[model samples]
Target: MLRRTAPCTQAPTTGTVLAGSLWHEAADPVTRRPGGPYGPLREPDVNGVALPEGFTSRIVARTGRRIGGVLWHPAPDGGACFPDGDGWIYVSNSEAPLLGGASAIRFGPGGAVVDAYRVLSGTNLNRAGGRTPWNSWLSCEEILRGRVFECDPYGSRAAMPRLAMGRFRHEAVSCDPDRGVVYLTEDEPDGCFYRFRPAYWGDLTSGVLEVLCATSDRGPVTWRRVPDPGGARAATRDQVGDAKHFSGGRGCHYADGLCLFATGGDDRVWAYDAERERLEVAYDAGAPPAAAEAVTPSGDLYVTRDGGDMEIDLITPDRVVTPVLRISGHPGSEITGPALSPGGDRLYFSSKRGPRGDASGTDGVTYEVTGPFRR
Candidate 1:
């Protein structure tokens, strides 16, 4: 079993802590043995998927295929569902190096595709990102000295690159509306966790980027402002010597005063109590590979598998772990972007390499799994 309790050793305080004296409840590991709830998965359906009996999946879009008039971009990743009036919009990122950008599919009230369009272009290697409280999508670039593009999910406004958010191999981000800060994760072996304190609450045009620093793994942490966020003088990760290194930081999600992030290098999900200024390991073993994560209305977390048999596992608020769905014959592909619809009845994700398992992900397939999800 992973260590549930670690003495939090406080590091020497330097500068003003952004979180100040605010503190919240200590975090507990959400990992638990499987088969605790939801029972076992049924046999594969017609779509070659195994679900919890009541759920069904359908292919919503395919690579090099037309949804409306636009061709669905290949290698779809990092998606978020936004409420669009009576319907909702699902925005997904394109992980193509040269043709990197983002696209969106608008769904009607009855969960039918109303339209499809591209919202961002001229970017590179668009990876995982997060949705803001204001309904905008933060499309991140996974490249050297990359950037975060704030995109409009409705595809009405133009996407803007948030240059002040620091330059690194960004994987995903999460917005803490209460603190007016946007947390970011880098995708390197020795990457550092970061947060952007915007000049204004909702504006990303300018901000003070800070890196997390601590003396121990599960200890009190401090936020140190990065001297140069642009990486013109030195790389953002090397700017601060004492910044905590998170091996291959991948997914990040902020909810209920806790920021949960996954580090793929170690296959661990860590929870940070921003208010309490403490960190804890949420899931270390006997859990999913811990790639991208999406939280449901009932507080259950859906984590996509980074490798192996393609599947998405659900971690309930009470700590039971179970498989939500599994995709067969896609061994070379990993699941990406497990996002819930605004109504919370449908889940959206993608098989990054499709059935053929191409390295370029040119034959990716986007899927929709509908079921009696908790509201």
Candidate 2:
């Protein structure tokens, strides 16, 4: 039999401390019995990596049971960071559960539990979303026919699929809220970069869908929408490739001054100056993906699977990438969902559990690695 105490309190929030502190609640092994779900964190260890000195790891929420106010499914995928006045707004990309289903959740306005509500409802395969200056959510669907829905944090979320953003396997998005430009990435093996500039600033549904062609220099020459895959994804890929205007199809980011970061799945990150329309290699981590994120205030970046242990990495402004922690590549250890707290003290990440009968099993658990983090 397995039992978990009601969360004693909201997960602890701490001031910056080197080496960091692990939640006292941790230290017991969380286990589940036959016909039961996994339990809350216990006996959690850093595995092989030791806390730098004051840093520590804590299991925030685990699979199957009530965690952070909601019932976590088999696996958590993408995540986002939002500013909550003095605090921070954190969201999870609860991807498709191996068991299958879509349950939407929200946090911070109240507590962490997920209540069945209509704020942003009914969708599966939720991946990642970009933070908007207007403070809204642009959650993307990872399914073949998935849609991008605009979720407003304050009122009712826009339910229509912003078709102007172009249809494909939308994975991640970077928004230039200042200029109303939303840069998005497709998950195709050789996915393309897309740009959507609202007909009116802040309006997402109305915009120009353009692809990018990287110039010998960093400037991406524009290739407007050619065609959505009409039965031939390869041919459509070729279409975006050979078009004279073919350009701007790598994944990209839009930050202050409109600097765009896009990668080619070839393990390359590009920094493009939208205002100057010039491009430059940001960093070359190798392999495909270019799939990464930039944490604010500190301007640090965490790169995801580029053919290695689904490890968590921090990219410094000096062009150096450092490993913070690594979950084993073993089935239940593949790191997927990761989001930073406002203070950057805690990192929330998720991975799927092993199959019901698999040895190193899991249902998918979300963990909170706390302690001090530096740029």
Candidate 3:
């Protein structure tokens, strides 16, 4: 049964409002200020990657390889890291036709891949997903009839689709455990921001799917239900009247009581305040934002650019935007699936289309970067 709790009483953190202001001002002006934590990005000694000073990375897994009886699925996209005993588990999405699903790579204490396997399969365009605080991975399918599937990262069970979450072109999801709510983003030119109030906290089996309606960036937000949860005829966006539109909505992550989402078509990252019923632009890069991942508890944000240099930009609690890593050599590929380990010392992300362009035939590559990151 679904459970209901009191509405979130937390106010928007001061840091959140400050970061929102950076969207309008100059990009990374604080970089010139003295004693910043960020330093110049160094060309990686390894091939196909680059990172900042004091940081090092290695390719953990790649597409088209066979491990544990399953072909390592191609088009490695969004992923999340989970704790597994003394080690860690990294679950990634495969954006391949027929083979699209999720793959899990278990990492040892020393950061080596101890074992890898296909945990979820037979889905469509599993682009990006988020891990719930309740110990499950919510993988999203980026196709018209796409649905959200909840996967057990430990492979204890089969992935189950949460049909009530609504059928649409889903990109990513962010869960607010405290409120038993999950925020979803659609990957269409006129996609809408969505929230699922699950019948039971952390249980997605049943819920009411609602779309946000906002007239401005600083919004007194409201919601309207999608007339059709099934994509039999009209899409949820077409059915929901007065729903707020996002340009090519992409990644979403929840932190500090706010849900942060990105629109690649508009090059903006927005924060939705559930408690206050407001939506505001947190950052605007003047170019499409590929994904937005938050460092939990700390409320810091990491966003990847949709095109061009394919750099992973970091937004500190103080609202300083800095380029942390750049995926060079791949012209058409973008850095995606920016996730932190359970401990936050290690960062994981993927370069869709690998080191070459999208036509390179090779699907993609995933990397792990370890360093002293501020919590």
Candidate 4:
């Protein structure tokens, strides 16, 4: 099992870490034996999905369904959970080819969608993104020449672009609240791992964008700044002279003082220790990974499979990868987003093209699986 590092001296006031620390509880491999923390999954009682023995899944929202006077956005991708009054707010990204953006769904008691609406609009190919320490969503546009937009989860505010975060085919982001730094992943075959240090901590309007350059897999690394944050004329990698190239960067999550990121082309997960200035491989699945992933409060990593017997694989602190949930019927669809609730009892994700691989974006569905997860 990975050893625990010293906690950040500066306390975080926003994001998932503040919602509830996933590091407080340690996962017991024995308990995760036959099934996992919850138990062996049983055939879904409702949505045709499956989960660990005591878990239950419900369709929270579906594509083409009109809610809050708008069609529930399709191609649901990366998402994050934020604290609400007594429940929580789930902000989901819609990676539609056109008219792509983000949507918000408020869950009250008993995991019910009290309200849902479009939080971001007028963007092209909104893909995977992460939540900020300030309680906002960084909606990424996956186009070759795209930018990151900060959207309000409440849908009351307009989406703003943070050009300083760099213009690239962004896939995911993970924020280090205490240090006030944000890690971003590019989705290109030879993409680079980047970190944005805002001029003023917690402010994304201006920052220095730097790419990682490590001599070894485990490293005492260095960073090289991107000549241009707005990749209008050239990509960030082309501008950064010494940027280290990664393979098809995808999902990223921050937990236990480490920034964990995945690369689909490499089928590997990597961990970066910002404080220690080190990088290490966490897991190599030997196959292309799903577009989204989530880490439990207890430090377990869950990655969805891109194809071929779709399943959500669990990686323990000891780096043991096991298939926990097998997604049935979604032949050509990829499991896009996998997000855990603030309380750590619920898991939320979406099937990109829905069960039958519908190309019209009308068959996508967002689901919530509630169960006894390690807190």
Candidate 5:
């Protein structure tokens, strides 16, 4: 494989793609192998996964297939959907397919790269992430020792030690288009809810990161500062950089209007309706079970958990979390990375069926699950 290294600086100006836009087209100019606008999927019945009796799945694109200049590695965890011309684009959060793999890199099947800044290196454990109104991916490192990274439409990447997001085991993130703020969650035995207010709005390094503390009045709790839990307490933080700066915030998003979407160790989905200054359990997926991902689209709210009875949980607009998809894998292979197509017509998730160590083509797959998302 031809490997390249570039500085992680400068104003990322990827020619064709916009920092605040979406990517949805085929990578190569030749035959246009569309990335996809997938809906609920069905396993192949024989050796593949089976969808619900009535729903169906067709492979729009999968990992390990060569789309353009890059042969994508099997998706281990984390992904994002961007607009790429007439079609939609998909980027995986994976290590390089080869031995010394790179992280936070992407291919162009969904869109074309007209600029010189393509391919990124050295970001790790990138689990679930949210698309920014600015059209970038806020990729988080799941390893108790990881950094909250920012990937631009132009392909330039940077790591932010902005201690505001809390320094715990980070799982996922979601954005608020109107407020221009990002909500975060932590993944640990006991974690917390957090919010990162970009003091400079779009600027990465400069921002105020905060955590949520549920109020007893059943009203909106105040933002608690994530402390420098040093020594043993700092385990989640030191692995990446500073322990005092980061906190263990996990899965979250803007589910209903300004109401914050949150879930994690508590197995609980809470909606912190900021406008109303009240906190409510939109749904309790359950506690002990880790709620890794959740998002509020037009129809319902969806979340995935990594626990004994691993299953993807779904909550209706009325606040109901039902077990939708059961994942089949151990620790590293646990299911994660749930992203939506630009139109919100489809859903995507990543599973690493491969062993804990192996990185490339380990029989892992990036799944396309479309709707009518039914049982």
Candidate 6:
């Protein structure tokens, strides 16, 4: 998810009324290429990463390794970078069963690791989450009856579980600052897209959880309150009468006026127009199975594959798709957490299972790719 500390100048009454204001269109002339904007990949680097020319890769942390005193967590999943005083902090989630929690790595202004610490603990399967406008990170759990935990990126405040966000197998979340709501995705085969309308902007203590309702795939959608967000009796997705079902929802991203998400089971990328209250398929075919997604300042989209060749594909504003980077020799591992640095020059992600390629995820690796990315 993208992180923004800037406050909205004009608050919209609801997400639907202000959704159109966030829609962005690229104007710069793009040179169409068969490979990608940066061109074809060279040979594999020392870190077993293949990138285009003028781009480089470096390993930041490995599973069970020591970084700034504490041992790095295994199975680094979804992560986001927040702007610190001089540099920034990147927080990553561990997908390990009982040990699943989140850790953070603070960097210096020159992009050097200064500190590493734990942010959230005693959680299960900390899958993916979004960055709030208030400079906090929402770490989601992907399990039956899972909940969303709001963690302080500075490691100052205790992680709090926002029960109002609903109880389900969460995949990721995206925050719409203008509407004071956060969009959430589930990883079930019949998952539903949802939004949590907080009682007040910048607060998540109390809120009305809603699921998207539409009569058709391309919809003039509406929001219906989830009668039971806690899922005490029935799962939140089933509480709504006509809640639209999304197959394997993951990697949700919200920008100017659009919320884009990917469903791995259906192999489609869906875009919801907040202002127009319309839903449309952005990319349906001829791409890898999408899991985690991130957006650049220039409106370009980057999506990571769930399992297939361990690659991260880039989708241009013009709808051109190409592989930006691919991991070599990591057969069973998948790419996760494709987030950009605060400066928008370095890309950070991890190989979930790493070299061991076992289901235990005991040997994960996190790397950073630097290049002249389109800002």
TM-score of each: 0.91, 0.69, 0.88, 0.88, 0.65, 0.91
Overall local distance difference test of candidate 6: 0.78
Clashing residue pairs found in predicted model 1:
23-275
Stretches of candidate 3 off by over 4 Å are 1-36, 294-298, 359-361
Residue-level lDDT of model 4, residues 171-270, one tens digit each, is: 8887886577889889999998999999997679998999998767666789888888887788888886667788888877665576767787767767
Clashes of 4: 4
Greater TM-score among 4 and 6 belongs to 6
Summed backbone clashes in each candidate are 1, 32, 3, 4, 37, 5
Predicted candidate 6 versus true structure: per-residue lDDT over 1-375, tens digit per residue = 222211111111111121322332222222334477889987899999999999999999998999985688889998888778768888899998988989999888888999999999999998878777677888999999898999997899999999889899998888887677899998899999999999997889898999999988775899999999999999888998899998888777776667877787877767788878788775565544556455664556676765557877776656566778889988889888777777678888899899779787889999989898876
Task: Select the stronger candidate by TM-score from 2 and 5.
Answer: 2
lDDT of 5 by residue, 250-313 (tens): 4555533443344443444455665554566543432433443434223434456554444455
Per residue, candidate 1 scores C-alpha lDDT tens digits across 148-241 of 9999988889999999998899998888776889899999999999999999988999989999999887879999999999999899999999
Prediction 6 TM-score vs. true = 0.91
Clashes of 5: 37
> Which lDDT tens digits does candidate 3 get at residues 60-161?
777787655456777888787777877888788888777788988887877777888877889988877777766688888999879999999888899999
Clashes of 1: 1
lDDT of 5 at 219: 52
* Residue 55 error, candidate 2, Å: 1.8
Candidate 2 residue-wise lDDT, 1-375, digit = tens? 000000111111111111101111122222212111111223325543223445566554555677544565545555554555444544555555333222334445323433322225567566565545555556677666556777654334444567767666666676655456777766666555567777887777676766656646344555566465332364334556543221233334454444344444444555545565545554444344324543434445555543445555554443345555555534334455455666566666655442231222236656666665653
How much does each candidate deviate from the true structure in C-alpha RMSD? 6.9, 11.3, 5.5, 4.8, 11.3, 4.4
State candidate 2's TM-score.
0.69
Better of 2 and 6 by TM-score: 6
Q: Which stretches of candidate 1 lie above 4 Å from their native place? A: 1-37, 286-288
